[model samples]
Target: MATNITWHPNLTYQERSELINQKGATIWLTGLSASGKSTIACALEQLLLKEKVTAYRLDGDNIRFGLNKDLGFSEKDRVENIRRIAEVSKLFADSCSIAVTSFISPYREDRDKARELHLNSNLKFIEVFVDVPLEVAEKRDPKGLYKKAREGVIKDFTGISAPYEAPIKPEIHIRTDLLSVEESALQIYNYLKEHNVL
Candidate 1:
């Protein structure tokens, strides 16, 4: 048997934004692990919350352990992982929440597919690249992921065994190597305000 679902064409994003007193946007934070994407995202969330803005975070590690547990690091699996996250973020945006997603998402095509899936013409998909050298990421190795990758214990590790395609024209590129967590978050927050997403 198949389940039937009802669809309702309700208010638009603009309408919802007006009612919420804030704009809706998908802040896609992409970079290697330990590149400070999640750190900055968390800080940004706190700042937004202080200002009473609705916000939600979609973390990659947390997601992989659940919704994408069956998936691997293969190209196809990676794409699917991001696809699911993007759809989830779109739902959050529809609820007038600022959806912030932090993922390695090394492939440009995978990231582009997310933009297509959401179908929001005015959807602010801010690509915040956590610019950090591969050596630095390995040195920091907050989770020992890099150590495992280097020892061949981990496969498809971005910037080690896997490829990471840097965005040529990301909306905002924050160098974690240079900016403190608070500074990076502030810069992103300011960008959201400039684009009317907060």
Candidate 2:
């Protein structure tokens, strides 16, 4: 005999939201490789921690080296990469955790698809565009990814061989070229404060 699945309604999101003293959300940072997305994300997480908030960061390099090791930079692989991260972010948000994900996520369609997976009123999926000119990003090649892509050593890289479509209207746009790391973090924190998420 097959066992029937049981249904159970445990704690409500409102209960959890009240307990945390804040709402659940995911900060999605999308930009070129050297556009300072990760830097700002890390800084923001530290600031949140100081304010007694729980924050988790998922960096592109860290994820690519592990969760997406088998994946290449092809369009399909890029979709899969962002899809996995989005699902993970949704899980974190559902658990009332602040999830910050830094990725290129070059395609608008792919990013929107990811957002659809967690289309909840409580889930504030903020898309932060780290705006840095291509020339500036190339100059700040901390990992030399730009040079490699230009030399054809790395194929399908965003903002180089591949395209990186900036968000038409991002929830937050941090101009990395103009703002210092601390300033960018403050901008993000102010946004969170304005939304009453922190």
Candidate 3:
């Protein structure tokens, strides 16, 4: 099945970047649920667009409604879900667009695989650790997921029934518990700018 595939592209990533006037990259935001990953990502997207940058967000829930609709919360399914998102993000990066992904990609191995994918492609992969205490996340419970998990309505939930392996040396670490949405987004935006990804 792989033998018949052929590469066909008229414009290179550099050309695309030249046309867009910005470099392409992937910003992988990982943390426990309600850790403000999505909130910060959305705000960052808006900021990037306001600066005339091409950016797109591949959020966890949004992907589940489409590309990952068939996947579930099982460990195996979760790995595949992140795998697919990482691949898609690479494609977006190859086209010179910023791919912002927000997911509770709890496993270190899984997140490492996504980083490897981007690194091998010569695309910037930023691992952002949206750090928030489990207690705080449960207290916030923006989606009521923590409540459901506590009631046994949901199983294999990260920071509850499942596990979340925090990044050892993330490119950026945002303590959402101590920062506002704008501040968190600005931290990420500053990272992209300092790294020449914007």
Residues 51-88, model 3: lDDT tens digits: 98889999976799999999999999999999999999
Mind giving the per-residue lDDT tens digits that candidate 1 earns over 54-140?
898889667888888999989989988988898888888777789989999999888887776665455667788888998888889
Model 2: worst 10 consecutive residues (lDDT sum):
114-123
Clashes of 1: 0
Off by over 4 Å in 1: 1-6, 119-121
TM-score for all models, in order of appearance: 0.92, 0.91, 0.96
Model 2 lDDT vs. the true structure? 0.88
User: Which pairs of residues collide in model 1?
Assistant: none
Q: In candidate 3, which residue ranges exceed 4 Å CA deviation? A: none
lDDT of every model, 2 decimals: 0.86, 0.88, 0.92
Q: After superposition, how far is residue 148 of candidate 2 from its true place, in Å?
A: 1.2
What lDDT does model 1 reach? 0.86
- Is 1 or 3 the stronger prediction by lDDT? 3
Model 2 TM: 0.91
Best TM-score goes to which candidate?
3
Residue range 68-183, candidate 2, lDDT tens digits: 89998788888899899999898788778789999989999888977777785447798999999999999989989899999999988888789988899899999999999999
Cα shift from native, residue 170, model 3 (Å): 0.3
